[model samples]
Target: MAGTAPSPSGAAAAAESVSDLNYLLRPLHWTAVLRHPSGAGRSPLCFRLYTFAMASFTLSFFCSEVIVLYREGTADLDVFTLTLSVADTDIIWLFRMAHAIVCERAFHKLALQVGRDFAEFVTWDDIPVLRVQCRKVRRFTLTYISFGIGACSCYLVSPVSAEGLPFILALPFDATQPLGFGVTWVYCMITTLHVVVMTMILDSFNVSLIAQLRMQITLLSSKIVSLAKEVSERPENYSETYAQYELRYRLLKCIRHHQTIIKNADLLERSLGAMLLAQSLSIGASACFQMFQIATSENLALAAYDAVTSLQECPLSLKRSLLLLMHRAQRPLRVTAGGFFPLSRESFVSVVNVSYSFFAILRNFKNEEE
Candidate 1:
């Protein structure tokens, strides 16, 4: 189950095992960022077109605001803040769109591999674990969507109450007129909804993958620790050779399982490294670090050592396998930010310190201006 390729017959079963993730992926499909798993919904050309249209609409709005700001030459802090906020969101959305387009094939491959890997856990009587994690992921995703919708509602409605456009964009027509206001308002609503919903889906999808990876690692650690107990429980009639064979087989499976885990982590980093780097820079290092708690390899090594010590009389081959597992696990498994720095707590601190230094310099410059 560990390193073995998924069989054709097991494909559907593997898909079923991780069906819970569709809660995240389904929204992405609707947004045309990805296609439906069954490949029944939209065509590739349609997805590409939809993405391009949305990106163009959002970028046009962003440019309108920038042009207005430049023309007005206003020093109002509120106006400046609003334009800055829009710019930030627009940049993030554009980056997400680019990622969806560039990594489309990689995403599909990763999804299939994830489903296949998760199938291995099904035989371990770990359905409950998967279910528990699925429930958590569902709750988190729904809660996030709810909040996003709520915020978007408030943003779209605020201008209605105040009798203005939702955002400060330079339109050709008189936006104060009823017809112009209606059109502009609807445009803002659509763009805002796109940005908010797509952002949530992409971010939540990444987090869900990390969460599932963490769960797999946890299950693997538990399996390693229980190896000795499982081998000891063999039937009384079982000979030493059979017991040794059983131990060796299970140990090899664990090794393969670890290899699969490492492969998934590397795939994730490769496919989403740029997006992760952009998110870390835009959202802050703390958020990135929180999302990157993918695996605890040291615990895996400890569990292997414990399994070896628990065995009253381990064979030389089995002992060597355990030693190798320990050695491999000792080297931490991590995802990096665009192949640059690792997404660890230490890196988070370094980012924060650098950000603060820059902030201080800007503050000093502003003070001198005053």
Candidate 2:
């Protein structure tokens, strides 16, 4: 709000006619975003490397899930060709969560700070459109919240887990392991496409939010300058007190506008960051999960790099995780789905065995942690 750019001739006219569209609409090249945003302060490569690694893991895990589902005969061959319609409800809520974080918590409080800054600059007429956008964001956010609840609660409760116990995962060491390497590549291609398309869509939403903020800021800047000029030119036509009041009123209005913009940006920062975080987690978890799956059929060291590359997957790993978790319904019913109630299994010992076995497998590995 304080940094003043030197004004150009007819700047006000140009501002009024400037394009309202604020962000780029094309699919993203994450490298560019990281390069520009990180500048001299932090290593952009740090985040990029971490994210890319995570994404790779997620795709691998998802491919494992798809393979498992195929083994169960629940999905069709066409599923291999189909693009999944993403469940964006979680996304919308993620945005809301960011807003609440800024408004109510510490990490995103910058939103409030920025909002306060922007409020110092805009007017009343501009408020209506901005308000409308806020309301839309709210509604979008609420729907996402509702969706997350339903996905976790409604679909996770399965019946098969308790009944069969460990029969499914008991690895018939000789159980004709899943498809061959050719099949692995097939699975990779399918999953890779899923990741790409979904990520583009996901990235677009964040970019759109940024674009909207940019456009609004430009509009508000013009309005503020226009108001200042009008007051200056007409001062002789009004009483001293009236002119002072008008000036104060306009300044206050701008303050409010500045606050709103700042709030929105802050909300977006956290929201966008959280989104990327969620994606990162998905990518990492799914990649690990897939590595675990591939290890099930193929050699562990055979494709370490491919395992790492799974992070490039666009949509990251959340949906894949959800889908894989959904498959858990038939496997051991750790999650909800297939029935309205929890499985009737003995809990404490089973949980311990599963947890212990998962870690014990690690100790036997002769390979370095690399």
Candidate 1 residue runs with Cα over 4 Å from true position? 1-15, 40-43, 160-163, 232-237, 284-370
Q: Estimate each model's TM-score.
A: 0.70, 0.32
lDDT of 2: 0.43
Q: For residues 137-179, could you state the per-residue lDDT of candidate 2 as single tens digits?
A: 5456445544544543433232222222111211223323344
Q: Which ten residues in a row have the lowest lDDT in candidate 1?
A: 285-294
lDDT of 1 by residue, 222-296 (tens): 678678666667678878887787779888878988888898888888888999888767665334333434453
- Candidate 2, position 267, lDDT: 67
Q: How high is the CA lDDT of each candidate model? A: 0.74, 0.43
- Kindly provide the TM-score of model 1 when superposed on the true structure, using C-alpha atoms: 0.70
